[model samples]
Target: MDNHTTIAAYNLAKSAYANYGVDTDKVLETLDNISISLHCWQADDVGDFETKSSSMGGGIQVTGNYPGKANTIEEMRADLEKVLSLLPGKHKLNLHTIYGEFNGEAVDRDQIEVKHFQGWIDWAKKNNVGIDFNASCFSHPYAEDGFTLSSKNPEIRSFWIEHVKRCREISNEIGKQLGTPCIHNTWIPDGSKDTCVDRLGHRTLLKEALDEIFEVEYDTNYMKDAVESKLFGIGSESMVVGSYDFYLGYAIKNNKLICLDNGHFHPTEQVGDKISSVIQYVDEVLLHMTRGVRWDSDHVVTVNDESLLIAQEVIRSGALDRTHVGLDFFDASINRIGAYVTGCRASRKAFLFALLEPTELIKAHEDKGENFERMFLLEQLKTLPWGAVWDFYCLQQQTALDNEVIALVNDYEQAELLERGEVLV
Candidate 1:
């Protein structure tokens, strides 16, 4: 799409939206301020730079091994740079503790420090992006039993507690240096695969561990903490220690952020519905946007109904400023960079579509009990020319348009990914 054609289409869209009292200009402006955090694990299929022999546990799995997995710190950084270039808005990078630059040394999770991630900090500064940190509690020997913070073994639990404390400290430093508060999220795969009678015991231990880990306070300006819950994973079918109820109560009591992952709930559960409810209690909430095919499959996100509803709810609840949006999925069956671009773009497009909605008009009708009118307007919104506005936003941001993404990704794959020689059959 040329500049002239984009501008003409956007002018039409702007005019059309004005009839419904929605300002296209203001929508675009709001979209510009929204930043999505790109998960670093996508580049390497959750295989970090650590020199350990631990296999992926905790019900976390990555499927399809497309060629060109980043095996080194430099390669991961380069891949992230490429992904940023393809995205439209300024975004942050989310890093797991395992992805730290270990410099060919064996640094256990509990032994990691700020120096190991100084390289990443410098790189983030160079790219003009902020960083979010995660404690890699899974895929370690201590977590093989599907427990970390909630482990019954005192030694194992203490190790994970130490690791999480270090992660928070590192996150604080990263935010202090970059002048953007780093959101450090903690998620563990602690659950029982079969029926268990000791659920309360595990929850008690987990709560104690968290209280101890968070005992040391850091400046909120530099770091904000969030706890993520999972419905059930492969080994955690019977029960999960950090269930949504547990975390919600913990967050509300502690005045901390609660992370609501789209793929972390039952199939019938809608994370969007929980957004408005959760925000009323917590000061802010973190969102991990992903697609789950019948389970927590961690598939790349798409601009589907669920995605749209999540964005719509965020906007409708007037919690846009209080929500921290981030992407979480690992689909190695396709090109890694393509996954990043596709998922990130889909998320942004969902938000863009939500912003383009005539929300005020619809809400006014609902307020007056005009159900038919509200339903009709919402149906009509599905066919609006929001795509034109989206294209113009992409044009303004100087990013690849939807039609051009395939060719761009293919070109990069041929030049970079195929040359890595780590093709998975």
Candidate 2:
């Protein structure tokens, strides 16, 4: 779309929204300020720049072998820069512990330090972006037994606890250097394949391990801690140690941020519904947006009913400041950069859709018991020119609009990704 056509369409959209007392300018400003953290693993299919690549385990797997996976830190950073250029607003990068730079030296998780990630901090500072960190508990020999932070074996449990503690320290340093509170999230893959008889024992061990890990205090201005839970995974289909109830209870009692992964709940359990309820208890929340077809597959996010509801709840509850959005998917079936752009674009669109909603009018009707008017108004809103506003956003941000982004991805693939000399397709 040309600039003139986009401007004309946006003027129409702006007027249409004004009729419903919605301020398009305010919505655009809000969207501009909102930053979603893009996952780094998406570039290399979760394969990090470590000295040795461990086999995927702990119920996490990235299928397909679409080529152009980044083999070095330089390549990964180059790919990420290209992705950022195609995105609308400024966003942060979420890094797994495995992606730390070790200068061709073998550094195990337990011995990792902030020095290993100094390069990343410098890169982020140069790019003017914030950073979020995660403790990689999977794809390790210790985690192959299907337990970490909740292992009955004291040696194994202590190793992971120390690893997590080090990760928090690293996050704190990164945040202090970058002048943003880095969110350090911990997710464990502890569970049983078959029906485990000693569920209580595992939960008790997990609680003890977490208590030890959180004993060290760090400045909240530098970093905030969060715990993530899952209902089940590939190997642990029977029971998961870090169930939703466990994390909810722990987060509430410990005053920690609770991470609600979209794909980590039962099919019937809506994450959006849980948002309002959880915010009432916890101080803040971190959302890992992904799609689950039949189980927790971690597919790329789409602008679907569930995503809309999640965005609506976040906006309606007035918790935008307290909530953090992050992407969590590794689809190697298509262009990796395309997957990143698609998921991030869908997330922003969802937020834009929510922001364009006439929530105040609908709430007024509900308060006055005008159910039919509320329903009609909401239905009418579905026909609004949100696409025009979105295109305007892309135009203002100098990113490709609609299908045009595909051409950018194709151009990058031809010029950069394919030239990396590791094309799988």
- Quality of model 1 by C-alpha lDDT: 0.93
Off by over 4 Å in 1: none
Off by over 4 Å in 2: 421-425
TM-score per candidate, in order? Answer: 0.99, 0.98
Per residue, candidate 1 scores C-alpha lDDT tens digits across 1-425 of: 78899999999999999999999999989999998999999999988788876788888889897999887888888899999988898799999998888777988989999999999999999999999999998888899888899999999999999999999999999999999999999999999999979999999999999999999999999999999999999899999999999999999999889999999999889899998899889999999999999999999999998999999999999999999999999998999999999999999999999988888889899999999999999999888899999999999999888888999899989998888987563
Tens digits of per-residue lDDT for model 2, 121-156? 999998889999999999998998899999988889
Q: Give each model's clash number.
A: 0, 1
**Candidate 2 lDDT for residue 301:** 93
Clashing pairs in 1: none
Ten residues in sequence with the least summed lDDT for candidate 1 = 416-425
Task: Kindly provide the TM-score of model 2 when superposed on the true structure, using C-alpha atoms.
Answer: 0.98
